[model samples]
Target chain A: MATTSRVARPRLSSTGDALRPDSNGSTRERLTALAFIAPALLGFAVFYFWPTLRGVYFSFTEYDVFNAPVFVGLDNYRALFADATFGNAMLVTVEYVAINIISQTVLALLIAVLLHRVTRSVFVRSIVVMPYLVANVVVALLFYWMLDAQIGITNQFLGWLGIEPVAFFGDQNLAIPTIALVNTWRHVGYTALLLFAGMVMIPHDVYEAGRVDGASEWKMFWRITLPLLRPVLALVLVITVVGSFQAFDTVAVTTAGGPGDASRVIQYYIFDLAFQRLQFGYASAVSVVLFVILAAVALVQLKLMRAGESDVA
Target chain B: MATTAAAPLDTEALLDRSAGGGGRPRRGPGRILAWVALVLIMAATLFPFLWMIRTAFSNGAALSTQPASLLPVEPTLGAFRRVLGLASTEEAQAQGGSGAAIDFGRYLLNSVLVSVLITAGQVFFGALAAYAFARLRWPGRDTVFFLFLTALMVPPIFTQLPNFLLMRDLGLLNTYAAIVLPFFFMTPFAIFFLRQFFLGIPHEVEEAARLDGAGPLRRFFGVILPMASGPITTLAILQYVQAWSEYFWPLLVASEENVRVLTVGLGIFRAQTPQGTPDWSGMMAGTLLAALPVLLLFAVFSRKIVNSIGFSGVK
Candidate 1:
């Protein structure tokens, strides 16, 4: 299974020497390194790089699966702007992302802080994080069963409280928010665990210092904890935003983007267009738009993080 | 102001005493509130799973009743038996009254095979590439690594349409390869994670191996791999859970019965059960079975998994 030649090599002092053009061992070292990385690089090229480029190309063409892709210039983009469902899908996606990020972040921060303060027991921490390991499909299914208007435990509890049993998935207005709630329910544990991990890295001395300064617990949280936790908090925010924008599995299983396209986010819209409607070119165009939005968001996050670091310095 | 001034000194004395005693700090009202909040959150978080267990054990008739019991009145394994294909249709109908036995065993096996292969493939290839990035020197290394990182920012939906078309043209649609190929090799996150770990290894160990006349491959295999086992194991667990939980791609490609993974199979199960009245008991059982493996993995490797999350965040 080994690909490299078994030639004995010199023990170079620094890695920089191995890259020198004048050295006799440089070519062989390069060969060995190339052999080591070839499999993954080859797979990446075939699966990710090539497909991404072709996808960009396809966005500009009018291709169904049946016919060869005919170059249509900007037709797909022009049509995407005019499509009412596409616009609605974008709006719905933004709403979904906003609710999901806000709820998940706030709940996760609360749970993480609580867990960090109360316990160091692995058992308790695992209990909080366990739901995250469960598949999104399973979470969506369980919630679907619980939110079933007629016999769902949620509705039953509401009835006991003298409230009307509202249809979660049946009503267009409640559908996206309901899905967002379920998504948050499924992921908040993970976000909390990640944030908790970050919290653990904050030295105990820092808290003691806050105590020394006569800071209230609330003051310490706002002034010290949140400020010190910026890096991980940014990570959590970016992950939540990216994930919520691409929300698919829960919507697929629960609403199927239903109640009259009320829950149809852009990812599901792309899936429906490509797989169900066979509109490959239009879907590609939408995919490019999605790609641009995500990339821009990531770049902005990186820039903001860098600026934050420099300010701290 | 006097109390606030004394509080820090008191806390310092407490800490010094605890340091000598090697015991935990005293619990206060804050601790009590934290516990109360934790208990409430835990109840909310775990209630769904508890409900799933209740439904899985209850018969279909019990579920249809008004004000469903929090605990099953008459517990039975009939739903589990039917979902696993171990129960006869006649027996299921006799017990639950309108249950159908799905070929869930096949789907379970498919899920296991796909997840294992993808996990193994990703960890192995990711390690190889990470080793190169960490220790080896080659021209254009930084550029190539930058390109790989760029892949992380591209939303997966961007590639789904083209990947589907490519799979169709290659006649790989509906095959397990279709589900496994794109993801099985490596991912940018895995490479970045493993590279950080590999870079932490001391250079002196590899130098000693060189003194013993060991080739680069032998040194890597005999030394670096063993030293990095902790991170490797963490990556394996994380990757396995991720692969098993995958849904969207599998649904897109593995539409055939023979190749269908559990997630897609469950989706189809939900869709196929008559509108407005689903097989709740059986569906609950299916959901339980699907979630059990990752849950078991977490139960065993909870500490390592938690540490891995912390480790990933540090950089």
Candidate 2:
């Protein structure tokens, strides 16, 4: 599509072999194309495409590895309604997503605007994104060390301020939020750079026009920059929200849904159900719900935010 | 975050000197405030890493007492030595290590093997599929591409369960193939990323090759691949970092000590140590080693990675 729009001509050769624009050549082209995509197609089928169908099918059955999946239509979904831990997982995941998205988006917006208006230093931006480049497990462990209740650097600093040491991961109330914050610290810079990319695409003349009208930086940012930046912000939100919903790695490494299941996001819960409890069918049901939620979120946000059609020309 | 562009900003003036828009003077309080925020962000961003270095160098026994200090307390190579299995059991215990004979050097090699294999396979197969999607006129082309893309929305857990079952049933568990198989194929993102790049290659480049009686394969190899090398390298870097940082799938499929990649090894290492202030120096040292390869890659390709952040989500 990208090529055809630009070239404005018939294809150089529909037959892959330009020397022979004949029936055999077209057949050869088809075979070549198939060969090109054969590995990906096989992988897609075995790994992705089939699993999606199997997951949905498993939701309707009662299966552990010992027995064949008994056809118990809707049993897993009905079970989920009464499952408090499943409900907690859903709640915890939502809380995590909300915290992560809000904090990350707000901080990233501030950083993006700062970079756009005051500095475009590659050095500064690189520093900001360093945490993101590290593995999630590595980041989680680093923070787990830094925020340990007794000897953590954070608590050590709090002591200097005469503040009570907080149990970042030990307290049930604090575990999820702490996990969210740790991830936010890792992510904020990358998010900021993403928003900055969007900000770069907005024409300078719009800001120039605002300055000509004697608009303060505050007013210009609010009235001009933010409005023109809707599409980009929407994209970032969609990406971040979707990404946060799959918060397994950090939780697995750090809290392990701990401080009394306070941080068991849905993904970890699914792992627990499928692996630890051997309830593969029930886990599949939860996964289906997660799949639906992600699909709905992506679609709804894109629709509401008008991601394709930007406010700016 | 512009984490990798160490080469670009070695000095203090992070502000791009070419920043001429907005008409704000360079010396105002607003500018000063911006610089302060930049400094604070940079400091906050780099602190954990710097602290990782500090903690990695500290004597694990002295870590808790001087946790707030900027420098290591009774600095030693004990942690690094223990994690790498260089320290004897008694020496490891003496330095507050868990005294587990875990070989991090082996895990590092394991990580190298897994990440390199996956990167090579994912990039190569993805490029092939991308070429088909971008350049071919086969029937159902766009539809097939769209089918591949919707896989992205399928949360990994959905596939992860069945894939694990498949791996186990095949009796491939604890082997690299089990872990590598799931990721060795092209990601939807990888395919999409390469396809987008391929589509932008001017047709004439391939047209000349084709007019020389070159077949599709020859055109792809001779013209398209070289022209799209930049995106290919970027995608490879992105994918390598991704494979190196992978924890979830590798954790599930390859749980054996020898097969375990760095992320999983680090997780288990963190788990093995006893609770209260348990040998953080050793763990941080291990963490730093696990993260080193990707960091080195980032240092070399900082701008490339930084430039590609806008399109990133897979990592």
Candidate 3:
């Protein structure tokens, strides 16, 4: 209990107290803080700040490999809008984000609620968090074999139910779903782990009050649990949305944008242009579009989430 | 209004009757169904991993017989041997021929070296920057910090071409620098994470050290840093796992065999196979090797990693 209190204590008061004039150590203390922070600040500017400036500038130039960038004056942005592949990539990205947002959050919440109620043993807690430890590549590889239609265990199990072997990765309809399912499988555990932490922090007396009122489990969950969980839920949703917009690796590895680029997500498309086709300017323009999309989505989501919190209170 | 007040007396009498009825040996079917549903979901969740372990041990001959065995009727160490390079050509050919010759040991060593160096660099630079951002009074610190945060949402692909150009110009291509340099330095995520942890730490501790006549560097090195060891270690573990698992950036730059990390190497190896029918056994072997560093890190710092995910999101 004391340790929990210590962990929960605010640090501002302590710091304010230390800054009192009679201490005679104020100037030296500030100097020490500055010294500690200098190395990081220097690296941040050179690596992050400078490159960010360069990225914005390069978006307007036509630069292929083996040549200096020449100012193109919005030609790259024009080409991006006119490109068919960009449209397809945009469609694919929407489907991916939509499916992932719904599935990852809902399943994460369900699993979190389930895990929160595990009263039998503490061992369940550790086992529940294990999948998040596995790398994305490993998860991808695992799903690749599992969905291989020929020797895949998923197909083999379906055969037992008298269903024909399905081309999960090959089919246009199945490809996005396959990737979404695999992503959800890998991330659900991690998301649930976070949600469970939120659940754990809720004071026990609130639940007891619901019990005293003879509230049904569903009613209590809807009225009490979810309202209290809005902050963490909102946080996860925003991050997931931004992350889904950047989805590249799993699709790249699983299908390589195959079956005539059926799973050609925007990020992968941008990558092919920059690296494979040497269209650096065009890729940067698409990247800027993606950045705008993500920024807008995040901003709207934050506003709605804040509104939800106010409404609940 | 008088009837509304009198209704409570009638509800009290009914509640007393219902309480007696509720204890009459009846159980809620909803609760029972919820438990059953939970068990089924758990099984569904865990079955894939169980099947993976089973598949890793089975071979081609037994892999496709009438009524294929669920428990590996003729289990063999052949797959593991071929993966680890102990099998002869006959065993290799039986699995999927020359395609499975991934040289897992070499790839394993490469991954370890890259991940370790990247993790060390990320933590060091992240700490320095985080310290500055958290405690230092610098010109335009908040603006610079926000700029770095914007990098987090930029979708790494945006910077790929530019970074590639920069790296090529510097002649860092086809080297460990290609894989490590871009990422081995400070990451915004790490800096943000560490800054939040640092902000949570009390200033009194460092002030107390200063009162002892210790200089700024001494207070930071001796006081704030020691206090931050928990979160610093957590960030290190997260960065290590991410660096070990990174595929795309490394895929873009590390084209040469000499500098190829495991993830890219595996992809290229898979692509070069006959008609793109990737050598399943070898890919699995390569994947297992690639996953070792992350798995080991998790084993060492399971609690810290799990806790960090929550703390990381809090900021």
What is the Cα-based TM-score of model 3?
Answer: 0.87
Candidates, ranked, DockQ: 2, 1, 3
Query: Number of the top candidate by DockQ?
Result: 2
| Candidate 2: residue B30 Cα off by (Å) | 0.6
Clashes of 3: 3
Query: Once superposed on the true structure, which residue ranges of model 2 sit more than 4 Å away at CA?
Result: A1-25, A307-310, B1-25, B312-315
Error of 1 at A120 (Å): 1.7
For candidate 3, give the lDDT of residue B49.
60
Give me the candidate number with maximum TM-score.
Answer: 2
TM-score of chain B only, all predictions?
A: 0.88, 0.91, 0.82
Weakest ten-residue segment in model 2 chain A by summed lDDT: A1-10
Q: lDDT tens digits, residues B109-206, model 3?
A: 77778889988987887777676666655455556665665566555665666777778888888788778877766676777666666665777776
Q: What is the interface RMSD of each candidate, in Å?
A: 10.9, 6.6, 12.4
DockQ, each predicted model: 0.34, 0.41, 0.32
Q: Lowest-lDDT window of 10 residues in candidate 1 chain A?
A: A1-10
Per-residue C-alpha lDDT of model 2 across residues A1-313, encoded as one tens digit per residue? 1121111121322333343444233666678889999999999999998878888898888889667889899989999999999999999999999999999999999899888888776767777788877899999999999998888899999999999999898899889999999999989998898777666656666777777788878897898778877766776677789889989988998888897889999999999999889899999999999989988998897675663343444
What is the Cα-based lDDT of residue A181 in candidate 1? 91
Report the C-alpha lDDT of model 1 over B1-315, residue by residue, as the tens digit: 000000001112222333421222247787687788999999998899999999889886567674468896468998888877788878776555345547778998999999999998988998888888777777777778778766776788777778888898899999989999998776776776677667657788787887899877887799999998888888889788888998988998897889989999889888866475777888888999999988988888887776566525221
Show how many residue pairs clash in every candidate, following the order shown.
0, 6, 3
